[model samples]
Target: MKNLLYFFLLTFTVVHAQDKPNILWITIEDTSPQFIGCYGNKDASTPVIDKLAEQGIRFTNAFSTGTVCSPSRSTIITGVPTFKMGTGNHRSNYPIPDFIHGFPDYLQQQGYYTSNNVKTDYNIANEKDFIKEAWNESSRTASWRGRSKEQPFFSVFNFAESHQSRTMSMSFDWYVKNVWNYLPEDDKIADDAFEMPPFYNDTPEMRKQFARVYNSIKLTDNRIGELLEKLDKDGLRDNTIIFFYADHGEGMPRGKTNGINLGYRVPFIVWFPEKYKHLSPWGEAGSVTDELISFEDLAPTMISLAGGKVPDYLNGRILIGENRSQPKDYLLLSSDRADNGPDLVRTITDGRFVYSRNFMPFMPEMRYIRYIEIADITKHMRSDFKLKKLNTLQEKIFKTRPHEVLYDVENDIWETNNLVYNSEYNAILKKMRNQLDTKVLQARDILFAPEYEIGLISKNQTPYLYRLDDAKYPFQDIYNVASLSGLKSKKTAKEQIKLLKSKNEIVRYWAAVGLMSQNKTTLESFKNKLMVALHDKYPPVAITVAAIVHENFKTEESTQLLKQYCKSDNMDLALMTINYLLYVDDKAPFIETIKKVHDMPNRNYNVKAGCMDFLGILNIVENTSKTEN
Candidate 1:
């Protein structure tokens, strides 16, 4: 018995030793490389990140698959391209493949206790089972300590301070009052020195916007430093392999959570004190590697470092030690939906050259009002185009793009100059086009197929627009939807209704969506129209109608209709019905319904969570009501 115990102990020790490097992935929300001192941003003071870069490796040319949080994070965790993961668009509703496991999940399988700091917006079918524990920043440290000591740990900490709506009014004012005074007279003050991107005009308001952004980044840096200090206090610093990165690009005019290079390109730094000296296959400490890397590579790299086998389904390569090869021959970046501009654009980049394929080429540059509103410089430029205060070179970059574009990054760093028209670049452009075509085909992009479908169904016998050619005004309906959302007066209701009759299903859907926000009188005519839409072939339209009805009306007829639909053979419609029922009366029945659905063995966790969350919300509401009563 003693000898057998010794042998088992020896085996456990060997396995434990192999997995000593605990991964601590620190992700910042909506941040860009420009804020980090390690990335050569002298204006920003990011000592914590700078120290980490010095200890390990800082990747200079890392790009995210998508510019937004959901798609980028989904690609990172799945070790697959956004398109392959069915998360090519924002807020994806499709089920996540079982084979696609998050790095933390993989680590847990290897006996590591994995935890996350509250944010898990991977846009997966179900998000509950992804992490072992999730807590707000305040409780994250305590939660980490509460984990079992026998197992090594993997923890992801996300800092949300830098997120848009940078609510640091006091900090912003301080920076303006103090930091601005320290700079030399020639040094560009935020009010004078700030230059807008190609899409915007140079204006003082734009400069102030830049200043506010800088202050937000500073606050993020401070929080990151605090988290690092906690790791040290807990004596986990030496053993932890810290990886720091932003979810996507900075949220600004052209960069605001879009698929553009400025939006997707991010900073990536990895530091492991235990293996610091030995893991320099790429280069020395603080050495910036120009090798193009993407978020997809992160999961495989983490898994490989944890002494685990890389699953064959993962498309990314491990980027540590001997595996430091040149980046993918051509990296693909894509965007689908955000705000009011439902545009689709894809780009192929080979470090030196970038080729963009715009599916919606006719969409105006400033299709979304939010983009224009926040873009102080663009607003100014559009207000007075006659002034020509904006440079012509910048104007060309801001103007509507063509179906195809080629940029030599070596010469045009800002991607301002298009070399596609040049005869000399024709061969390069052709090669890139072929590569993109082949990649899309290989990836099984739905759009590339002969019978490409837009995943919409409507019974109104409307003309369904299908085409191989790129359409420019695909986002006009989206813009109209925005107008409806912002409408305050009854006078605009008729105009809003007119916009809802657009040929695009997305437009009509948004119009119906906008009606839900109005008063009873405004929605009276629209409600009957919406009820008629419940029979619309499109599941989303039906689901939206059901939701609106359930929220506004608690009639027995409506409840019966919802309950009947909830039992439908079509799981999509059924799910939508259950969601609507949750918004209506009788908490007990709704909770029971959710529990019954959740108890099913084969139902997806997301489906379960969708039901369970309603119960959770009811519990909260009940507690609040009890206190008040």
Candidate 2:
């Protein structure tokens, strides 16, 4: 009798799982809404995504948490913003909290076979140290059809056909042999087909590069259609909820790592099958909504649909199906410290208006980050900046930017005009400024924390928690001092100098960076204090002092101090030290210091991926290096 009872319970469990709906995510890399047909661009050929838009609700305002790949992908799977969870930096291989695995773990507990048909790069390292989870399987061979007949499933398909590396095929040889050579030569767009943005020169060669990007998009569209066709043939279309979107923005010159709309804005479409239309929040077919969505929301909405608990720790809220609810009025976006160097920027968008706050307003030379320099278009931009080929509006890229910028994105699409100085929009700009401040304080954003120490913060629950337990640097003071450049008072410099004596190493480091940028003339007045800072226990602080002493005093001690940092044992610190020397002169005496790391067999992925891509321009300038872009 007990054996019969067990059999009956098993049958009920299988039937219960089959009754739930299936969720499918089809994600592509490095694309914006501007490349798609339904999102205002009719020139590009994306019939599959356009058809999907027509069948479901299309979102006009959607964004990702971070502008870069690893950080943004990390937020997508965990339903938590990397900034709050202490995984904000790119590809650091940081350890996450014990309670946090991913939304798929919740679905698995509820009886769903979750599979990712190929890429799973969420930045957080997997427990086994191979990659992220491998439920059933996570490759091209993994499929929903392979599951039991009565078991519902959740599947994710990631397409990399339109990644930035693929777009560089026309000029970059690495892209040509690996990505472009595989595609049909005949499947190309017309030369000079689209209007180039203000950031790029309007030349025939520039237009040709843009054409290659459109062709890659075409390949991704074809792939999406094939996958959808398979769902129809298997008779699972009516039982599935299909979502199509991009991971982040395209990597076309200035678009990739920057915090502009071209970086974070993505095309998002959701196709609710006719039978499952009742479960959707907006059941109207072919309808469009102006609601804003973030990458962090995907996991929570999917977990809620699987009849599992949504963790309170998630930064995102449900945006689709029955559990959908609005959390805040505006969507926040940030980008920090990519492979190029240490850069910090934040943006707040309320669907139409955009307000940007640049904390590091003095470092305008970052416009030539290594990955961007590899593009043929940027070469034209740099030569134009020197030759006066560009207009005053186009020349803004070369110089330091103002503290704040405001844009009415609807009218000024390219964001060419700055209205922050304009009196008419002062009221709107103030409200937007206050809105951003409220969000930043509420989240306790660790924008000023040292990037090298972020990995350790992740293991101790989070940066915020560690600060609370230890009370180092008085967290809020660092953000205030980092933004001290905007103030004209001499007292601000005094405040930073006082903080230089702090017991905390990270606080002392940023204080030195702030003191130099705020007022270098005042630095000589505190030579005794500045000399003490030159020998800081932290390399980041000592490195900045090296730049200050060399740039201001030009002493022998500064050169020796600079050489010591160039050979730092930590790879991240070593590369940053090299970048600091290049910021002043075309070449440094310690170029061989970084070259030795390139020779080491035990180097980390961060050093391997960078290899002074930023500093390699010296060799290119000398016409000596033969490395790939």
Candidate 3:
């Protein structure tokens, strides 16, 4: 009788699990909404994705937390923003708290089998273990088919057909074989089929390269169609909630790594089957919602759908189900260092307008990021620039950006015009600016702490927790000093110079950045103060001051200091010093110093890449590093 009772209990448990809804996430890489038919792009040929939007809920305003792949995926996996986790930089591998694992761990606790079809670039220090704990199976062949009979499963199939390489980076011949050839003749996009974005020059060479965007997305759509067919073939279509979306924005030159809407916005759709239609917060079939959603919201929403408890550490809102939170007023987006490029930019978008603060105004939107710089399209643009073929607007990518920029993205899809200086929109800009400040302070954003300092603190404690300690972070003090970075005026210069005497090294570091951002005339007046700061105890501060003195005053002393740190044992410091040297007009003095660092054994790849870029620009040698974008 006891054996019979145990058998009955096990049967009941399995039956209960079968009643739960299955969740399927169909994710594509490096795509933007502007290139999709559902988003009103006439030139797009994405029939499968458009069908999902037609039969499901199409989100009009969705965004990624970060611009690049790993950082953005890091936020999607953990229900927290990269800024708060100290994982804002691309592929930084910073450690978070032990209690914080992937959100799928919650679903598993709720008796659901979880599978990820082999793309776990979570960007955490303990990635392998994290994946093992989060999913029942995570491999190319892993699937929900492996689950027990009648047990509900949550599976993610990530398609990389639309990644940056196929879209732009790889050679055209490779693209033809991999992407274009896969599409039907009718689906294949002609070179002149689509209108190019105004940002790029409208030459035939440019158009030929731009066609990859359309063809690659079409091939990705074909893959999506195949997966949907399998779901129906298995007779699980009615029981599964299908989610179709891209990892971030388009993989185009400026779209992938930039902080603007073109980089952060993504295509998001949720198709609720008849059985799970009640879970839709917005209506049932073929509904369109203008609600603001971000990558940070994915974890909590998925956990909520699985009928699991959402951890307090997960700050994202539950987007669907009975626990659906109210819509957000605005979304905060961030972009940090990617590959050999070092930048810090934060943006706030309220669905219609985008306001950006370029903390590192010294770097251009199209700076010498080795990953993008080596691309054929980038080479084409650079060639046009050298030949004086590009207009002023096209040339803007190569120049330093302003401290702040505002755009009515609704009206200006290309985001070419700046509204920050417009008197008519001053009130709107001020409100958005204040919102960003409040959000950053409340989150205790760890990215405000330099990457080198984050490394130092992570040795003793995780940067995620270290940011919360007011005594250790002093975020307000650091933020105030950093905010004065790009303001070039008498008052601002005087204030930054005074902050150079602060006890905090980070504060002094920003002060040096502020002084460096000033014009040559302003820097000349403060030469004495800068000369003292050039020998700052903090290597980062010294490096910034060195760049200023060497560039403006043409002093060898400052260049010598920069060159010494180029070979510093600290790779972060070495990378920092090398980036500044890349901007200097004369590369003769630092040639040997750069080559030595590049030849150093076991040097950081990014540092070596930076040195390699410098040498390549001077016709010394081509960069041969096999580092992935």
Candidate 4:
């Protein structure tokens, strides 16, 4: 019996060694495949990436859940949608409980050495809440080299030389009035940018800036080459599964933080080394596949490669290894509050068509984040806007967005054309709308709340009440209110009033949204109730109350009432205060209140950045007036 047991243990160890492959993710930040030579950009100096593609399988249709780092990383970490995790806002960190561990924890349980060479900005409230057991080591010095020889590893390394911030000269780059690429002081870029996209004017400066970005890509590619060289020298190359991908798209104007293809589409290459080729679902070298994959899919793929079962809770699928599945028919995209203000956006794409729903259609897409304004691209875009050099198509992004947008992803990959208005595409529009609505409803997206409420819940470690079915605004309830708000019928005024008086704060907030949709005269009847709602505990409820005050009264008293929340210790409240105050009046008195917020310490980064930008724009306006005089 002892001999038999020993034989079984030896067999188990040998089989385990063969089945598990070391997964190494060489994560390059703030770049897209379009910027790489392998992805058809002749201007890019990306020999390493091109070589990786030659050795691996290249995926042309991979999408990221977000355009920015935090929200996208949150989804990647949790293997869940950003909204579902309640970490939807960029620069905000929401905690994950001990019991609910990330995929790395599962890998660690199976004795896999998990290491991350720094970059743990997972948008969690308590980053320490990260399960320590999930990683053998996670630091700048952490590497699979330190792991025991018998143990396979799952390691992630981030190269940020290509990040937008690195290309700039100063830490406060955005605060400067004029911004340009500070690296490679003497830029050697000629007047060319592959094919300048329609939005950009073909100018020497623009071409130079584009070339500077290519230079950064080249630097990042060389870094990748060095890392791969180290792997080959260690003689672990054949036993490893290598993945090269960007955090998101290139961080530039109309890309990066935006929820468009220019922002979300990323380069993905999976190298199943010759020794492990049979383990790969693709089972081939140097192939191109059109797979609709998202960052969420990475967690499950890693889990499967570690010889572990993918959990049902994870929305991702095993893209390779055992239990491998076909590519997704569609992938979802979501972006919310990239900076200080709110830009509630959700999208669904099936490789051919892309559809987006902008819940806050009243808000312009180019809200000019104070920090991001440091880029020269922003200065150029805004200058074009002021000079009226931009055509109607160019101005659309700066203006209030359409509630819904439909684009032919194949014909218009840049998403310039909105096919929603075309009667011929009505059926297609309906189908896309239904697909998006179903996704939102199915996820019970907590973004149904106002920005303040979303911000509030996101800041607090444990979620307020956002569960699949347990939230204050369940999927169907919010869906019903959403449908009703569109009608804006005077006949439903009484029903809305009842909702405003409901016990649930979410209900009252939606009720206010419905009331605000109506014409001022039609909504006048609720003046007293809105005033009472001003004293509501929740910021979302109070925001609606303030909106009503601005619409109905627009008085000094209302501004003062909103100002009370400026020092309320929450950036969201302060920014919302500024938003309301600015909407009502942008005079000296209101501007003072905004400055007061700028003066506050420990304020959220986005809010502080936003205030600075707003002040800068105001300064520009004031200077222009003086010049004219």
Candidate 5:
């Protein structure tokens, strides 16, 4: 019996050794395949990526489940669609400690030491479960060698170089300043050569803005080269299976952090020295397959390769080796919240066609601020509403979208042409719509249900109630309210006043947010309630109220409220006070607030930048007025 058991154990070990592969996933931020040479970009000089393609396989039609960082990463890590995980929106604050079972945890169970090099944007229940070793705080190169060699490992190295808001440190300013240097001068800076994507007008300034974006990409590619060189030098290249992909598309108008195909469709390349000879079912080295795959497939693929059992909760399928399945008939993508507002958009795409469902069809496709940031011409164009020579890209960015949209991707690579109304494509649209309906039903999407119950249940009362079924508004429920819906509603005003007096901190904060959106009498009532809320044990509520008052009101009362809160021990609240002061053009007061909070512990850099930016905007506005005078 002992001999028979030993033989069986040996056999099992041999099989497991053959099945497991060391996984090294390199996820880059804000990139698309269209810019890479392997994906047919003639201008991009991504030699490292092209070399990887020469060794492994390149996916022609890889898609991200969502466009934004959190949702896309969540979908990839959880191996589930964003809608299924109840995390389709960015504002759905991930409740920690649940451990929603990621691929890394599965691999750990299989005895692989899993580690991530920064970038844990997974809307996971508990971040600790996903990243057992907090290697993200350190450099990627150092993190790679931090692991033990005894255990075959799964390492994720995320490069942030491609991220938008390109830094001056990287010499990326050249791309923005010298757009004509890269492209031909004859290439009409304002003409059809620069295809103005739908929702954008055809303007010269918009064209110039796109040139800056292209420059940022160039800088990102340089960083990729550095990382790849480091991997080769560490002698990890031979055994490691390196897979490169982007979190989402470039943060440009219509694309970037939104849920358009331009936003979600990204570059994907895999390179494994041992497995390089064995072609993926799609093709051999440097071959690009037009298979429809989403980020959701990533987790399952990694799990399967690591010889780990794929979880039942995952909707993703493994797409490697003998088990490689054909691409799905359609891929689903969704976006809910990013920055300050809610944008609920759903997209279904086959290889040839794309169908979109804009839940908030009335809202303009592009945010005004984002548009101005990307295209300088947009800033000029906005000043003259009657200007008829609006660029196509500008038009696409500013225009209101229809409820449903259909595009022939085969012909319209830029997605400028909408074919939803064309009779010829009615059947195709109907088929895709039916597919979405069936999938949503199968997934048991809660959005389809008539009632969505929110709020808490306590020992005494049944808890608070907010019936979303009747609310009709899709995205507004998630924000601070003051940012979108101005202070105007009487009912919400009354509710805010009542809630500000609540014993619970959570309820009080939400109420304060509501109050920030009400009229004068309600505002006064809100202020009184805030005085009581400020004294409450909860620091966040006090800080939030102080910020709201400073942002909305410019009176002496608002200034006093801010001054009081700026003295709080909570650095976050103090920062908020400073930010609010900055927003209301009270620069002197803002500087004083900042000076007080300068030494406060745990002050967020982004908050500080927001304050600075606001100050800069004030100066710019002031200077422009002076020049005009």
Candidate 6:
């Protein structure tokens, strides 16, 4: 009787597993909804993706929590925002709690076979083990085909044809040979056929390069069609649900790493087979929903679909199925350091208006990030800037940005206008600012601390857990000081000057940054305070104050301070110091110091990159180490 009872239990488990729907995710890299045909772009040739939208529900408002790939992928896998995880900086690989497994682990526990083929750039320490635990099979050929008979599956296929490399960074000849060469003649996009965005110069060189965006996407669409065809042939089409979306925004120069809507918005569609049609919260086939969904919502939503309990630690709401939570009123997005470029921006969007607070307002939107600076598009734009061929609007990319910017993406699709100071949008601006502040503090955002500090903290505890200790992080105080950055007023400067004496080093660091954001005239009155802060115990505070003094007063004392810190053994501090040297009035005095740091063995990538940038600006090419590691 006991043996017979065990057999019955095994039968029930198999049947229950077979009843669950198989989920297939088709993720393309670096694409925005504006570039897709389903999103009303006449120039796009994404017929397969548009057809998928017609067969399912199209999400009109979908965003990536982060603008870049690795950090965005980290959020998707964990259902945690980058700011909270301390993974906002690209490729930082900061340690997270060992118990914090990817959401797919929950699906695996529920007897679903998971596979990823095969992009696993999750941007957290111990990523190899994390990926290993999440997927039954994760390789170039990983798929549902490897799962047991009658078992449900969650399979992800990442397409790279529309990635940044194919779109802009790679040589045009390589694009033609690789992406365009495989396209059918009729599907090929013509250079003249595409309309150029107003922000870019309309010269032949620009048009020829921009046209790659269209053709590369067309190739991506073709691949999606082939995959759909294979799914039908495999006889799983009847029970499989298909999700099609991109990792982040477009891979173009101003789109991928930016904090605006163009950088975070993605093309998202979910197709439910007849077996799982009842599970979709959005209506039937061909429906479009404007519900605000971000990458953070994906993990819990997927776990909910797989019949697993959503953990409380996952902040994202269950976006679909019976457990679907209420839609978000606003989404908080972040953009941080991407490849040796230091910046911090927090953005909020209500599916129509987008607001961004540029904490590092001194750097232009198109700052000299080493990875992008080497791209052909960036080089071309730089040449155009030097020739003064670009219009005022086009040249704005290289200029310092406003402290705050608001855009009505519904009306201004290109985001050419700033509505932050406009009287009519004052209420909206205030609402967004308040919402951003509340959300950041609620999450106890750890990215506000310098990466150097995060590294030190991570040595003792994971940043995810470290942030929860209010006494250690003192986030409210730090946030209060950080929020003062870019508010151009003597009153704000006075407040920052007073806070420079805060006992907390992080708070003092932010206070110094606030003073740095002020105009030279306003800083003149606070010169004494700034000078004293240049010797503050915290290296970041001293480095920031040094930048202010070097830029305005050109004091020899401040110059020497910056030079000394540039060679500090602490790479993060060294990176901070070298970055400040890039903007100062006198680059000559720092040349030798930068060169010495540049030639230092085993230097941090950001520090070495900054040194190279400083030397490059002076047109001084020096012998440097070849490898970043």
* Candidate No. with top lDDT: 6
- List TM-scores for all candidates, in order: 0.65, 0.90, 0.96, 0.87, 0.66, 0.95
Can you rank all candidates by TM-score, best first? Answer: 3, 6, 2, 4, 5, 1
Model 4 agreement with the true structure over 360-410: per-residue lDDT tens digits: 555566666664676666666766676667878778777756667788867
Model 5 global lDDT (CA atoms, 0 to 1): 0.59
On the 0 to 100 scale, the lDDT of residue 356 in model 2 is 78
lDDT of each: 0.60, 0.73, 0.88, 0.72, 0.59, 0.88
Displacement of residue 428 (Cα, Å) in model 4 is 1.8
- The model with the greatest TM-score is 3
Of models 1 and 5, which has the larger lDDT?
Answer: 1
Off by over 4 Å in 1: 1-19, 131-143, 167-199, 274-276, 321-327, 369-389, 393-398, 447-629
lDDT of 1 by residue, 52-104 (tens): 88877888777888877777777876777766545655665545555566766
Error of 1 at 444 (Å): 0.8
Pitting candidate 1 against candidate 6, the one with the higher lDDT is 6
TM-score of 5: 0.66
Q: Name the lDDT value of residue 262 in candidate 1.
A: 69
Give the per-residue lDDT digits (tens) of candidate 3, residues 99-202: 88898899887778899997988888989999999999999998889888998899999999999999888888888898887878887899999989998999
lDDT of 5 by residue, 1-629 (tens): 99999778755554455445666887887777766677766655566778888778787678888877887887777777766555555534434224356667777656565667777777644556455542322334435565544446677877765565441112335444533244344432332233444455445555555545445555555556777788789876666777888888766556765656787788888776764446356566666777888888888887777666677666677887665556688887776655333455667888678787665453456542331233344344443333434555545555556657788866776777778888998899999877765665455442221111211211122111111222422222222222222335666676566666665454555556445444455566556555555555665556556656655455465566667766555433554454445434345655655554544565544344444444444555565566557
Compared with the true structure, the alpha-carbon lDDT of candidate 2 equals: 0.73
Summed backbone clashes in each candidate are 3, 0, 0, 7, 22, 0
Clash pairs of candidate 4? 93-123, 93-124, 93-125, 94-123, 94-124, 94-125, 174-374
Who is ahead in TM-score, 1 or 6? Answer: 6
